[model samples]
Structure formats: structure tokens, C-alpha cells
Target: MAPTPDEQSRTRTLEGVLWMLGSGLSFVAVNGIVRHLGTELPAAQGAFIRFAFGVLFLLPMLVQLLRRGLPAGTLGLFGLRGAVHTAAVICWFYAMARIPVAEVTAIGYLNPVLVTLGAALFFGERLAFRRIAAILVALVGALIVLRPGLRDLAPGHLAQLGAAAFFAGSYLFARRLSDLAGAGAIVGMLSLSVTIGLLPFALLVWVPVGPVPLAWLALVAAFATLGHYCMTRAFASAPLAVTQPVTFLQLVWATLLGALVFSEGVDPFVLLGGAVIIGAISFITWRESVLRRQRSSAVIQNG
Candidate 1:
């Protein structure tokens, strides 16, 4: 007999939690690698190597795709997502080189809020009042973290902001493609496209580095591959609603890593701002969950 709905939901929730944890750790590891590389490697080179290695790591998935054949009508969407993701990777790598890991992670939380707004505006998803309020709150939190007027923001900060926006676009495209393509295809395309996209810049800025940089680059590939794998597993196990909040744990891990590994100090404003962002994200997650449950309940009732 098939499992009951409640049992299935519970199983999915547990799996999602595990996946989110893996995602968080993978991201932290990526950050660690970036920190380790520092200025030794150009950001573009780092981005290129990271994606190139990621493609190699995902070769098994590609083989499966070859066996199954590509999905119909998804290449365009995949290409769009890949392009946006390539932009995000470049910005994120640049920011990582210039900013503290914890700060970058904190600022990166803005992506979810942006995603919510994008879904509402472009996808015609209903924008609940609570979600709107949450977005505003999160924006304020971002401003606090940025402290725009009080201090000059670095070019890296702006790059990170741009990255967050582009990442939201990538997510939107991915969500659309999810209906037509397997996750493997999405990951494969992303890795391949980003590697290709970064090639020119990587070549232009190529530095003849020693083995240490190459080692760090390889580590970056490993971390990103694992992180994405864990993320894919999480989504497979549970709905996005359940898995989303678990991602916030990344900030905590990043903070610890930044402080201990890099000897980077966190500012009070960053903590306060991060708290606000977390609270807003939590609110958004809770609201979305409630909405999803209500819709499901209604559908069941009608059935």
C-alpha cells in the first residue's frame, strides 16, 4: 500500500531538512575555497575553474541525459538560466575575493526576497499582503547591512547586489523549466554554460600560478558540486517551502567560518541586519507554507 499523505509529508520534510543542511555546508565550503584563493587567482579564473570542474563532476548525470535524450522545448529556458547563473557566479566570485564571507552570505539572503517579488510580478503569483510587508522589511535589513549613506560601498558590494538580482532571474527560469526538464539537465547546462561564458574573461586574466591555486580551484569545484547535489536531493525529497528555511542556517555557518578560518571580524550592523533579514525570510517562508497548505486543503475538499 502507498503511504498516507501525512506520512509522505513527514518523510519529505525530513529529507528536505537534510538537503538544506548539505546545501548550507557546501556553500560554506565554497566560500572557504574562495577565501583560500583570495587574490592569488583572478575571480574570473576561479569562476571558470569552478564551473569546469563542476561539469566534470556532473559527467555521470550528463551520461544519463544522453541515454534518456534531451527534454523537448527546454533548451531556450536552460540557456537563459545558464546565462543568468553565469553572471551571478562572476559577481559572487568577485565579491568573495573582496568582502568577508559572512557579509557576502548575509547580503545574499536578498535573493529570496527578490524571487518572491519576481514571482508575483512576472509569474502572476498572488502577492499576499504579508509577503509584501516581508519584502519591505527585508529591504530595510539589506539597507542596514549595506549602511549605504554611512559608509562607501565597495565595487564588490555592488557586484554582489547585481549577483543576487541575476540569481533571482536564474531561479525564476529554473522554476519554469522544472516542468519540462530534469534537474540533471538544469545542472549540466548551468555548469557547461558558465564554464563557456567565463572562458574569455578567464583567458584574458589568466595568471601563471603555482599548484596551490589549482588545488584551491579544484576544492571550489568539489564544494560547489556537493552543495548543488545536496540541494537537488533536498528538493527531490521535499517541497521548496519546507526546504527554504533550512537555508538560513548557511549564514550561521558562514559567520563561524569567516571568523575562525579567515580571522574576519563581524560588525554589529551586519549581525543586526542579518537578524532582520532572517526574520523577514522566516515570515515569507511561513506565509508561503500556510498559503500552500490552504490551497491543498481546498483542492482536497473539492475533490
Candidate 2:
């Protein structure tokens, strides 16, 4: 029997949650590799190589696009997204190099909150009171996690913060592109464009990479590509509001990885702050989803 709309929604949310869990695991693995590789590779080079090697995985997508001509002007948008995404990824690699995996993961959780503000500021979206209050809660959480005065700010922390912002920008563009392209196309553009964007910079400061490090970066690219594919599946299965909250699992996974693999001590404050931020974001997502459903029902009634 065909499921009712409510049942379908519930099923979709469940699928999204599972896909997000997969994405979290994939990203955690990537972070672990990036942390290890950071000791040997420059952040720029790691990022560039990740994308460059990632292109090999995305080859089928490239071939598909070539076989069927791309829509006019899409390449430019892809290029722009690639440039912005590369900046974020470089910062991420740098942060992973300097900070504990858990710390970087904690700071990274602020992406959705940043994306909300960016939408309001850059895209002129209306911000409701509840969303504004939720955002403030997230800000407080970020401060708690960072504890700027309590601990001297590390350059890696600052870089991770920038990474979160640029990641938000990349996400916004990816969301826009999703409307016009398939998941393969979006990922292909990102991999190809980011490689192109970083090539010149990589060429200037390039260092010889040993075989072991090269293999590590290849694994990073592989996991990252899988992570993105999972993310795309999650987003397609359910609304972002439903899936974004599940991504908080990355912090937990990162903390475990840091403790078990790197012998890094876990900070309670980071976990607490991440919890608060995730809680607030979850509420905001629920609120927005409710509003959307209500508006849809109202339109149905009026029609």
C-alpha cells in the first residue's frame, strides 16, 4: 500500500538521518587522515591534492557532462563555488594540522548557524524572532567552545572559524546548484573547480610528497568524496532542516577519534557547547519545518 504523506515524511527523515550518520563517519575518517597527513603536507598542497586526486573518482561524472553538454553559464557558477569551497577546505586542512580533531569538529558545527545569518544578510531572507534567539544561543555556544579569554586563541582556531564561514558559503552555492544539476554534476564541479582554483597556488609552494603521504591524501579524497555523496543523498531524501541536525554526530566521532588515536584529551566544555549549539539548531529546524507545513496546509485550505 502507498504510504500517506506523513508516513512518507517520517520515512524520509529516517533515511536522511541514516545517510547523515554515514556522512559523519566518512568525514570523521577524512579528518583523521587529514590530521595525520598535516604533519607532512602543507595545508594548501593537501587540499589541492585532495581535489586533484578526487577528480579521478569524479571522472565518470566529467565524462557524463562532456557527453551531454552542460547548461549555459553553469560552469561559471561551478567555478565560483569551487573557488569559495577551496578556501574553506584549505582552512579546514590547516586547522586539522594545528588543533585537536575534537576542537576543530566543535568549531565546525557552527556552519548551519552561519549559513542562517548569511542568508539573512546576503540573500535578504526574513529572520524570525525564534531563529534570531536560536542563533544567539549558537553564538554563546561557540564562545563557550572557544573560551577566547580563558585560553589564548590559536591560529588554527581562527582558521577553523574562517573555514566554518566559507563552508557556509560553499553550502549555499551547492544548495543553489542542486536545483539545476544532479549530485554527480555538483560534486564533479566542486572537485574539478577546486583543483583548478588551487593549482597555481599549489604549484608555487609545492613540496615533494612521499608515497605514504600520497596514499593518505588519496584516502582523504576518497572518504571526502563518499562523504559528499552521502550528504547529497541525505539532502535529497529529506529537507536540510531534518538532516543538518544529525551532522552534529561528527563532533562525537571526532572526539572519540582524537582520544583513541591521537591521545588528545577531551574537553568537557567543547562537548557541552556543541550540545547547546546542536540543540538550538535542532529547535530552529523543527520550528521552520512546522511553519512550512502550516503554510502549506493554509494554502491547501484556501485553494
Q: Candidate 1's error at 58, in angstroms? A: 1.5
Residues 80-109, candidate 2, lDDT per residue (tens digit)? Answer: 898898899889889999999988988888
Model 1 regions lying over 4 Å from their true place: 1-18, 64-69, 235-243
TM-scores for candidates 1 onward, in order: 0.90, 0.92
lDDT against the true structure, each candidate: 0.86, 0.89
Clashes of 2: 0
Q: Which ten residues in a row have the lowest lDDT in candidate 2?
A: 69-78
Pairs that clash in candidate 1: none
The clash count for each model shown is: 0, 0
Candidate 1 residue-wise lDDT, 1-303, digit = tens: 999999988988897899889899998998988977887878888889878877888888877876887788887777778788888988999999999888898899999899999998899998878888999999999999999989999998999999999999999998998898877787787777778888998999998878777777888888777887898889889877678777778888888898888999967788778779878988888777788799999999999
* Candidate 2 to truth, TM: 0.92
Top model number, TM-score: 2
In model 1, the worst 10-residue window by lDDT is 239-248
